[model samples]
Target: MSHHTLPRPGASVFVYEWPVRLWHWANALFILVLIVSGWFIARPLPTMQIGEATHQFVMGYIRFAHFAAGQLLTVGFLGRIYWAFVGNHHARQAFYLPLWQKSWWRDVLHEARWYAFLESRPGIHVGHNPLAQIAMFLFMVVGMTFMIVTGFALYAEGAQRGSLPDQLFGWLHDALGNSQLMHSLHHLGMYFVVIFMTAHIYLAIREDIMSRQTMVSTMINGYRSFKDDDAA
Candidate 1:
C-alpha cells in the first residue's frame, strides 16, 4: 500500500457516469459515420455514364449523411461540454491544463516515463492522467472545435447567403477570403481526428492489457477496477 499514491487502487472506482458513457459511444459512432461520409464528399467516386446527373444521386446522399453526422457531432460536443460543468471533477479534467501546478507536471513526467518503459508500472488514476488529459484537451477538445467550426463554415457556403449556418459562421468566409484555403484547413482537421483516433485506440488497448488498472472497458462500463492493491 505504501507505493500507492493518488486514487488508491485496492477497490473499484466509478470513473465515468452513464451520461459520460452514453455520450462517448454516441460520439464514437458519429465520428465513424462522419469520417466515411466526409471522405466521399472530399474525393467522390467516378461518375457513372449510364444515366443523367439527376439520376445519379449518390453524391447528394453522401453529402446529406455528412451533414447529418456533423450536426450529431456538434450536438454531442455541446452536450459533453455541459456535462463537464455539472458532472464530477473527472468530467472537467480534459478541458484545461494545470500549467501552474508543479505536482501535476511531475505526474505528467512520471506517466511519460512509464510510456517510455522507464517505469515498471503506471500511476493509478480514476480520471485521465495528466498526459492523457493533455492529449484529450488537444485532440478531443481542440480538435472537435476546429472540425465543427470549419465544417459549419463550409456548410454555410453551400447553404447560401442567409441560412442559419451562414448566419452563424459567415464571418469565416470574409476572414479566409477564399474557399480553397478553408477546404484545405478542414481537410487537415479531419486528418488530425483520424490520427488522434488511432493513437487513442492503441493506447487504450495497451493500457488495458499492460497496466494493473482497467482502461478499455472503463468507458464501456463506467468503472475503473484495479488488479492490484498497490498503485504505481
Candidate 2:
C-alpha cells in the first residue's frame, strides 16, 4: 500500500488502553527492581561475610523484595496476555507473528533501509514495527519460561523432596545436570531481558526526540498523537 493511502493524523486511532499502560510501566519498574536486588543476592561483596548477621539481613531483604516484585510481574504478565486476545485490533495484532513471508521480507528491508538512512521517512505501521513485534513475542516466551523454571528451582530448595516444586523441577534438574544449571539459565535469561530493556528505552527516546511524539506518554495516557502523514 502507498504511504499516502494510510490513515492521516487525527484519524481517530484507538491505540492503547489504561490497563495495558498501567501494567506495562508497573512491570517495567518491578523488573528493574528485581534485576538489581537479584544481582546483589547472587554475588555478595567480598568484605561481607556470608554468615554474619548483617549479611543475612541484607540477603533476607533482597529475597523478600525479589519475591514481592516477582508476584507483581506475574500479575502484570497475565493481564497483558489476557488483553492480547481481548484488546483492540491493534493491540491484539501488535506483536503477532507474520503469516506472509513476502510481507515479512518487505518489512525487514524497510526497517533496514530506514536504519541505514536510505529512506528519508519512517515506515507506516499500524501496530508494532516488525522487529519490535518479534522481539516482544520472543521476550514473552523466554521471560515466562525462565520465571517458571527459576521459581520452581527456588521453591524446591526449600520444600520437601516430594513436594510440588521439587517434583516439577526434577526433570529439568536432571536434564540440565542439577539445580545449579537451572540457576545459571535463570541468570542468563536476565541478560537477554536487560538487552531488550536497553534497546527498548533507547528506541523510545530516539523516536520521541526525532518525531516530537511522546513515546513515553503513550504508556501513561494510552494515546500517541501522530501526524497523518507521519511514517508511523
Candidate 3:
C-alpha cells in the first residue's frame, strides 16, 4: 500500500447499516407500488362488466392500493428521517449538503464531468459522491416530501371535508386556490422521481463496472469494497 493510503486492495468499509438497507429496499418497493397504482388511478381501465357492478370495484381497489402504498411510504420516510439522526454518517447523506465546503463543490464538478464523459475516472466515495448528495437532497428528500403532501392533499378531497386527512391537508387546496392545479403539480413530480431513478440505476451500474469499487452490492451487503487504491 502507498504511504498515504490506509489499506490494500479488497479493503472494505461498513457504510450502510441494516436499517438503512431495509429502508432503501422498502422505500423502492413502496414507490413501485405507488407508481403502478397511481398510474391506473390517473388513467383508469375500461369499464368491464365482470360479475355484478358492486362486486367489481376495480377502480376502488386501485385507489386503495395507491393510498395504502402512499401511507406506507410516508411512514417509511419518517423512519428514514429518524434514522438519519441516529444511524451512521452515510445514513444522513441524503438529507443535507455541505454547500460551504470548497472541496465538496469541486468533487461535484468532477463527478459531473465524469458523468458527462469529460472525465475518465470517478471520485471514490464511501457514501454517496458529492453530486449524488445533491441529487438525493433534491429528489428523494424534497421530491418525496412534495409527493406525500400533494398526494394526501388530493386524498383529502375524497376523504370528505371534515375528515382527518382533510383537516391536516386541506389548506393545500386553499393555498393553490385550485385542486386541479395541485393535482397537476403532483403528477409532474412523479416524472421527476422516475427520471432520477433511471439516472441513479444507470450510474450505479456504470460505476460498478467501470469505476474502482463495488456499487449495487454495497447497498445489499452494506460494505463498500475498493478494487484498487489509485487516486482519482
Best candidate, TM-score-wise?
A: 3
Give the candidates in order of lDDT, highest first.
3, 1, 2
Q: Which stretches of model 1 miss by more than 4 angstroms?
A: 1-10, 49-51, 229-232
The local distance difference test score of each candidate is: 0.86, 0.69, 0.87
- Residue 187 alpha-carbon offset, candidate 3, angstroms: 0.9
Task: Compose the digit string of candidate 2's lDDT tens values, residues 1-232.
Answer: 2143466665534567877777778988888888887787688545556676854676677888877887678777777778878887656654467657677768767867776789777666555666666777777555655765676676577665888768877566767777777778778877888988988889878766654234666666776656544335
lDDT of 1 by residue, 91-114 (tens): 888899889988788889989999
Winner by lDDT: 3
Candidate 1 least-lDDT 10 residues: 1-10
Candidate 2 has a TM-score of 0.83
TM-score winner between candidates 1 and 2 = 1
Given candidate 3, what's the lDDT at residue 130?
A: 84
Q: In candidate 1, list every pair of residues with a backbone clash.
A: none
What is the overall TM-score of model 3 with all chains considered together? 0.94
Give per-residue CA lDDT, model 3, range 1-232, as digits (tens): 1122434567898889998999989999999898888888878888889989868889999999999999999999999999999998789988988988777888888889988899876667778888888889999999999999999999999998999999999999999999989988988988999998998899889889987778899999999898985643
Q: Candidate 2: which stretches are off by over 4 Å?
A: 1-5, 10-12, 46-56, 211-214, 228-232
